[model samples]
Target: MKGPHRIIIVGGGFGGLRAALELVKRRARLKSFEVTLVDRETRHIYSPLLYEVCTGGLDADMGRASVQELKSGVAVPFSDFERRVKKSRLHFVRGELTGLDEEAKEIALKDGRTLPYDDLILACGGAPNTFGIPGVEEHAFFLKWLPDALRIRARIAAFLEARRKGKERRVCVLIAGGGPTGTESAAELANFFQRMTDAGVLDREAWHVRLVEAGPTVLPNHPEPVRQAARKRLEALGVDVMTGTKLNKIEPGRACLTIADDGEECIREADVVVWAGGIKPPAAWKSLKLPVDAKGWLMAEPSLQLKGKDHVWGLGDAVSFMHPKTGVRVPALAQVATREAAIVAENVTRLLERRPAITWNPPEYWMTVTPLGGHHAIADLGRFVLTGFPGYVARKVADLMYFCSILPWRQALRLWAKGTMVYMRND
Candidate 1:
């Protein structure tokens, strides 16, 4: 008598895609509903490898290859999933979310289209947080999106060309923030420069890659042993690590900061500044009038459903979920988000069948592998740790495991092999 129930998912990120694919796997049993995934981007970019793209690993001249042309190596277009989704009730829509009406069960897009849904999953992720720092928006480069990485690559290429032509004297790169992104980026850039210098491709008296952290140490959230290992690797690579420093402002080719110990102002000249500071929930989240925590992240119950909204669920960086035991908010990591996607997908199926939804209880420990530079990484596996080439291998295996989860075996292996060939050459 009624059409199939509609289930719409906003955002095609780690959690959203996982949820969509999970639903596709259960299409036979969940035949009463159709699924739709909405995202602004046509392709799902592998954000972890963005640094590799920025450091001249993909191409020396990024302008020659359009983002569309380079999509195969680093990103997977939504259309590529159609093979597995053939005859399934899953659909993909390209649109930017503007607003939503919970009462009307409609979502409004910037293009003036409205989509009605019986159940909604919000995985709309975060954006770069500049902390309102002046000149940062215009001067500093970001690595969040594909274009951002290309821009950084172009800048690096230009700087190197100038140095080779005797137009520049030094390669001064200033990276703000000392988390995983900042540390990994700095390491990769250092390796690139070293290779160029060794090959006599550039004529510079010296090169500098400075990593600045406002906190007391780099990788502040990692364990003490991991931090020490990272510091050792960074020092060996000759990266200038500055901790306990605050970046007050950023200008063209320069940055101003203050040393915490002396409380004295300092200025550093730069060839380019890369902003790896942090991220915050997209402003669009607030417009939906959803229940949000004090920091503006959507608040969800233990079942991953939005607080006070039984028909809506939230996941990934868009939601604020505190650990039941530690009472601390979960860190925004791809692994955690993927794990949460499974819970949300299960609960959604239970909801459809009128079964009680199960509560979310994540694992106490998750593996984290951060690639430093060259064939080196720090893999933290609960009580045990691995570094050097072994850790790098672990990181690669972990990546392959994730690729297999989302893509068909053949397509996933092809994608994995393509990336491995492109990224492994640098080592």
Candidate 2:
């Protein structure tokens, strides 16, 4: 009799889910392997559409897919392998993971249950970093998860409704941090306000949007030309772009800031505050006591294996690997995470078969499509950047392509057409 071959995957984000799918696809020969995916949430959210949800461009319902739906699609061999495992063995315990002991190879859940694994893959993604600012956690809203997006949308809607009811009508929204997420969110909110005003759901004079950045300019990492064009577009839409402003504190309805240029302090009052600052790895990664970077991201070798650990791998936003050519750690983006998932999947299969794992290589060009409300967008395709109608079309096509990746071609096409028509009508 042989002991159970257990593989446990933590987190249901892009990388972990992809790894589970790949393993299921190859489960015929690895019938003895049992895989369990553990996630606190029951649904896997398409995080890119979260901005759309916040701005009323899309309903929150459209952003989620049930984990049961994903599990049902597992191949026959994988399903059989899972069924053969005991109830205690097939643990899908729903709770927060408290810690992990690398030496003991045990995971501690909040419910006080410990799970042991023969192999583990940590794809635990990131959480919004508040930087310990006073009153931020009490008042500022984050947009990292599905609930956060919905809460922001609800708060905005409530403010608009209050203004319509002859309230004070001072509904200014101050979004902190002007990265891609912050910029896209500001644009989307502006578009939503404009659309609502046009439809008589809101008053243009009653609502205002302000985008604040600590950097010298918005989107500093992007191409200079692209950044300028985006700034122009945002300004044209009436967004208050404040550059080089450091946030000091966020009170109940006011944000205190220090102007870098003048060293003068200012306070901006708002009905709602959205914090789209940077993200850091989850607490589980830090609790592992592994060799993690200062930001708590697991350090991995070029093969995507965790340092000092064999038969264990990590990827996505939770892991950091050095680039062979540049010797720089790659940014935690969706494209890199997906590519890393594929490489890790292949490497895991090879390891099981006693074959050598291949080295990982980064892509030459990385592209990002950012929506700027009402079919307008920006496409930064490495060498070139496109805006206006061309960029909008590219964004729509890219969204359809994402749907095609997850759904069948026919189903994806129908959904794309229906979604487009609905969006146009809503606008």
User: Largest TM-score belongs to which candidate?
Assistant: 1
The window of 10 residues in a row where model 1 has the poorest summed lDDT is 58-67
Best by lDDT: 1
lDDT of 1 by residue, 111-229 (tens): 99999998899998888999998888989998788888888877887776676677877868999999999999999888777766677775335688999999999999899999999
lDDT of 2 by residue, 35-136 (tens): 677777765555776676565533222233422222222211223324434443343445567877767887787888888877788788888898888877
Q: Which ten-residue region of model 2 has the weakest summed lDDT?
A: 67-76
What's the lDDT for all of these models? 0.85, 0.74
lDDT of 1 at 23: 77
Please give the TM-score that candidate 1 achieves against the real structure. Answer: 0.96
